[model samples]
Target: MDNTIFAQSIARIRSLETKMIDKAKIEAMVESRDFNDCLRFLQDTQYGSYITASNYEEGLKSATIDIYKEMYKICPLREVVDILALRYDSHNIKSLIKGKLAGIDTLYLTVDAGTIPVDRLNIMVKEENFRDMPKTLRYYVEKAFENYKNSQDPQDIDITIDKGIYEYMLEIAESSKMEYLLDIVKLMIDTINIKSFIRINIQERGRDFMQKVLLPKGNLDKDLFLNNITDSLESFANKIMHTDYFKWVKEGLGEYIKKGDLGSIEKYGDNYIIDYLKKAKLVSFGPDPIIAYILARENEIRAIRIILTGKRNDVSPDIIRERLRDVYV
Candidate 1:
């Protein structure tokens, strides 16, 4: 837990961070006349070597997996990077499970950068065998798949696996004894639980449903949500006014009231994480810097995807900009 051990990793991260795309570059992509022009803009940067307009999506995905693998190899406290990689693993697991049951191809949606190889995960799911999966993950997968077989409710697959991801992440963060990493994981849990709370309330699902989906060990109590299931969104926001997310949740509630979607809440949640990651900018040597750098890269890739997808689909620039999160730089 001595962050000083990350001194070398921090220096390497510092050098790599300089190449991160900035707000100006993002704007250039956003304003590009077409998708090819956007790819051309990226070609001038780090991704130019392989990112063709025709293959930009695959190129970007492949590059993402490569960068994560590189970062994982370089990080001194692998636990931190492992925490992030676990997220991708969790996401890939969900995509694989759903794809299998739905008889669809979700391969493109998988991010193959986790500690568990994505190909192995695909094989496990393909054959409906998970014995080789991580023990905690395998338990959840079997239970979810079994529940789905009986109930035929897809939400079980998502809810159960998501809970398993956070639970296992908490275990890693706690076992590493890293307070910064622990806080990040807890915050993610809180935000996800809050979002689930809103979704369940809107769906008219009760405490039983809330208990099924709401993750434990967050800053907010599971009962806090279970008890407030009947309250109006406004009242629920008021209920949590003393918590860290009061202001952000209230603002998102305002938008949800006007727009009938959780988009604003989700955007605010993502930006909040970016804000937390930015704290590492002042640290001289620690896992924080490395964690911030890789998450920043992930965030950067997301911004690029948003712009390119918007341009390809003819989404308005203004709307696209609205959807963009704050850059880590």
Candidate 2:
């Protein structure tokens, strides 16, 4: 985890980052006159070949898969890549399961960035056979099915799979024995829990609902959320001031309470993680830069989708801007 094993992969990723979608490019896309104009903005970057006026979604998914393929080839430790790919795998599991139960197409929501190929995963979910899937993911897939059967709730599929995603992430971090990876995973869990907490309160759900949604073993204690079930979001934000999330939670709550902007909380959380990942630039050689590059690409893909969707729907630039996540520098 702390060696020059990742030197080659980091070098390739460093060069790629330069060609990445920058802030100026993002602004051009956002301020574009229409959806076609936004497509023009991406045409000059790495996304040029894959994107078009009508099928930006396909391009985005392709770009995501291409990066994972490149990283898998260059990265010395495949597990490092697996840690990032696991998120996509979990996403596919959730989408496919829900789609199967509802008897509809959810392929558009699936990304090819997972460790398993998209076609194979779709088939696996269709046939209800995951024996060939990754062990951690397979177990979660089975559990999700059971949870859904018991509750007859499609939301159970999402929640169970979401929990599984982080569980597998934490396991990867712990097994890798990298303090950096472990800490990032913990912060992410804390962030997810916080978002869930906010959503339940915003929806006026009960503490019993909170108990079912919260994940296990983040840096923050579960009681911090359970005990604060009755407090306002503002009060809860004030309480977490001494924790690592003090700054964003405080600032984000302002927009949330005053304007009912839930996106602010999410934007601040993404910014927080990107700011944390910025430190990896100082590490001459390690897995840090590799993971940082992966997430940076993910952030870039999300921004592209946001701007294009906003353009298509004629949404305001200011409102769209609020929905965007922080760019990796």
Candidate 3:
């Protein structure tokens, strides 16, 4: 069966992922809160202590490198690697185009969404190799950049970029053979659409503006979202309640649509993805270190960023905690 190749590929990927996980635990010990334990772990793991003498942030770089180095030790599944590579490539493309359009310095944008190199990103953007990038990223860079170049409005650029990303992600997910991956992608699209709708319409913007910003993705019909929002939030919720996903947003939020309890929609979707993969890992064995683990780490990084930013701004931990997403252990 043709699936044999996929099965074999998965087996190799699993072996690699397990190796990385073990190595990562050792690295984590080096990064432990206890100073002496951390030092001992560092020595044991041979994670180099060469950090910038002038900046505390350099320690973060060193620690992150150790984490990823361990991850590399486990070996990644080809499909997992490809998916991540394409996602990061798309991000860099978006950053380049948006930075140019908004007149923001490229340095202000983050470089570490995945393993994308600055040199490769430079070449891709400089050459405008949208066609050569990846199927997952090609249409997004092209359409978003075209729209941004034509309009030059910051809001338009933001919306265009989001819409382009969602549309492209939806296309790929729909075509993908992996059921779990496709489900997660569709859920992500649903969340994006929901957020965009709320931000544009319920936030008092025009329906036309909402439509312009929304990506045409997911199982939900675009016209339904746009038309439903013309009524109250309850009506919209009720309309969605008929769908398979209605329970996710409706059960906890049905009573408080007026109070913005829906801000957690993104968090819920992210947690669901992580949880789904954690369960999948029990049944499957492959090189891909379960999408849940990756998403959880990503969420952890995001939470750390939010906390650090809040600290810098003197925002209370309470406020930061509210904004934090779920993390995997």
Candidate 4:
């Protein structure tokens, strides 16, 4: 893909960035007295027009779909868009496959923001016909089905499909020949690996489970994790302290040691990735800004959902604030 191809799209994304929910706005939403107050706050932003008191959830979903749809329309590089959107495809696949195995209707859970339409993906999964699907996706669906047949564990479907999505994403990034995007993908893969290592270690799961779930194409060596699977979390953190993830690992380890909450690790990892992506803001004409904008918008939506849900449940504002990840803005 030509770097110049995204010049116009990046400009548009820069304009759209002004409409994104900023830190102050998110703080206000967090401090909002009730769910209605939160909805009213959203109504005052880019998302305001899409949201209604009676259907905030649907409104948020609509806004998400609209953002992706707009990106598809504005960006000349569909491959870049597809690479980001493929995660949604993998998510829909997991929902559909799990629904099928359990005899449940999960159509509502599927999002249409993927490269392929939700209905078509549902059909492909149902008929086991993936001729038109991407090779990685096709492989994942087939392998997940076979795994499910043998183990009858729904989690097998999720694990298999997730690995496939990352593998496919890395392939797309490499094929695009964009080192920036490739670095971002590798960072994400490494983050996932780190988080998984922390979780699986806490669960005391062995190497087999680690081998099954650990994805390839990450910046971290798989053997580093394999070798340290039996070590203490502090020891594991010490090993990776020489890498880019040292700060986050240190903080997350502190949180884990203090509260036994793995969420702290996941949160730190997510914030670290977002912070890394924020570097794209310095680039003037490239796909990096476009990708950064998309991620920012997604993070904004996630923060809003957390605030609204917390407000609705009468959860404390301090608690919501604590759970909130760093905003891309």
Candidate 5:
């Protein structure tokens, strides 16, 4: 890829960065008196146009779709955007596959922002057609279907497709030859593996489950996890304490031991990734800024959703704030 190709796109992204929702704006939404108050706060920001729609969920969805649409239009390299958007494709596939198994319409759960169109994906899933999807994805879809057929468990579908998605991401990152992008994907894999390991341990699942669900290509090796899958949570945390995730894992383990909240791990992991992505701010050109901006915007949207949903449900602002992930801006 030509680094020069991203110069203009980076400039556009820099201008767009000014409009991202900052910490204070997110706080304002969090402190809003009620759901309507939260909605009103959103109306003054870049999300104003979308928030005016009848349903806040639909409005958020529209905003997300619009951001990807903008990214596709402005980015010179489509692959960069595709790397980030690949998760949505995996998500759509999971939803559709589960929906197919359960005899429900999963279209509502699908997002249109992925590299593949939701309708086409839905058609492919319905007809059991893998010819059009990427080979890695197609292979996983077939495998996931076969697993689900034998086990008749929806969780198998998620595990199979998720593993496939990260495998594809690793391929893209390697092929793109961008160290920054590869690092991001590796960080994501490590975080996911850590989270899954904790959950499986807590649930008292066996090594068989771990071997099947745990993804490869992360910073930690498959053997490392396999050897430690049966270890106690504290022992497991200690094992990984030498790695970059030491601080977060330590804190999350503390929370789990004290308050019994696994969410602490997830929260810390999310913020850790965001902090890692913040390094892209130092780059004045290339796809780093654009990728970072997209991630930041997506995180911003998630924070807003959490706040809005909390306000709607009469959840305490403190709880909402605790649940809020760090913003990129």
Candidate 6:
């Protein structure tokens, strides 16, 4: 436990959270009856608080990048930095390999997920040691190339790339010594598992084919979920009702009970997991400050983006508030 790094990371995350809270308060003030008060808040804080007016989905994506920028500033560990570098490098490779296969210009493929400089990733793509990229990313690039070569459909190739990334993420999660990181990875796996199971059972498509594509690091019994693939959605939900997650899943899925909108249910599952991780970060205080702070700031950025999106859409504040996930403090 290097208290120096731990304390610094914690302090940074708290500072970020406070800034986000102030932004939220300003946004709330804008929603109040006083248009003049909203104007005052806007003038006093500068327009940085105005992220609430951006497109919801895109804002979330930007927030992810912004939070990662902050995390990289505080995280001294080479493992985390290497992972980020590899991720961006892989994203660039995926774009290049896929774009070439599709007969499209390489510019069409963009890097959005990594902290690495775009020029650096481009250099890696041109280098012969692409296989030397992070182990997870090397696997992703090779798989994407292989999948593109074999598959005629672009969608199929893209799915192959995504599945490969998830598989690698799960492997990292299982092998890592950090319990919090493992939990975060497992939560991601669980969300993917839930979505995959529902799609398999309900649609009866791609049986035994994409089934193994799921990352299986979650606390949930992977075999149990797979075995129940033939059950109705309600039945599957009922089976897991004993767990603490059941209530959230039930409420999220209940909205589509009659309409049977699986997409919305899947979104609910993702949201819940994100919320769960935010809560998890709060309780994780120790030598793992690097892990905890990165995760917490990520969630806070997510919340800010959500609020910004809601305000932009002119959605009622209450509705937007209801949709807001927990921010780590």
Top model number, TM-score: 4
The residue-by-residue lDDT of candidate 2 on 210-256, one tens digit each, is 98899988999999999998789888988898998989888778877
Q: Once model 3 is optimally superposed onto the true structure by TM-score, how far is the C-alpha of residue 113 displaced, in angstroms? A: 4.0
User: What is each predicted model's overall lDDT from 0 to 1?
Assistant: 0.86, 0.86, 0.54, 0.87, 0.88, 0.57
Which tens-of-lDDT digit does each residue in 216-309 have in candidate 6? 5566887767677766778878988887568667876676675566656665775676456555345434334555455555555555555555
| lDDT comparing candidate 3 with the true structure | 0.54
Question: Candidate 4 overall Cα lDDT vs. reference?
Answer: 0.87
Question: How do the residues 217-294 of candidate 5 rate in per-residue lDDT, one tens digit apiece?
Answer: 888988777788888888887887789998888888887788788898898888888898898888876788888898
Cα deviation in Å at residue 129, candidate 4?
A: 1.5
Q: What's each prediction's clash count? A: 1, 0, 7, 1, 0, 1
Give me the runs in candidate 2 sitting further than 4 Å from their true place: none
| TM-score, prediction 2 | 0.95
Cα lDDT tens digits for candidate 4, 1-329: 56887888888888998888889988999988899988888877888788787777888888888989999899887877877898899889999998888888899998889888999988887787888988877888899999999998988999999999999999999998888778888888899899998898989997888998999979899998888888898898889878989999899888878987788998898899789888988887778887888888888888888888899899999999988899987
- As for lDDT, the candidate ahead, 1 or 2, is 2
Candidate 4 lands at a TM-score of 0.97
- Structure candidate 3, residue pairs in collision: 10-286, 13-286, 13-287, 14-286, 14-287, 16-74, 20-74
Output the better candidate (1/4) by TM-score. Answer: 4
Question: How many clashing pairs in candidate 6?
Answer: 1
Ranking by TM-score: 4, 5, 2, 1, 6, 3
Model 4, 310: alpha-carbon shift in Å?
Answer: 0.4
Q: Lowest summed-lDDT stretch of 10 residues in model 4?
A: 48-57
The pairs that clash in candidate 2 are none
TM-score of each: 0.93, 0.95, 0.70, 0.97, 0.96, 0.73
Model 1 clash pairs are 43-48
**How much is 223 displaced in model 1, in angstroms?**
1.2
Tens-digit lDDT track of model 3 for 1-329: 13333454456545534533243443353234443333344343323353222332445444544444444444333344334333554465667766665556574353444445656666566666856555645665666667766876655555655555555555554455556556666766777677666555556776777677666657688887777666776667678877755665564354235456656665555555555556645545443244554554445445544544455456654666666655455
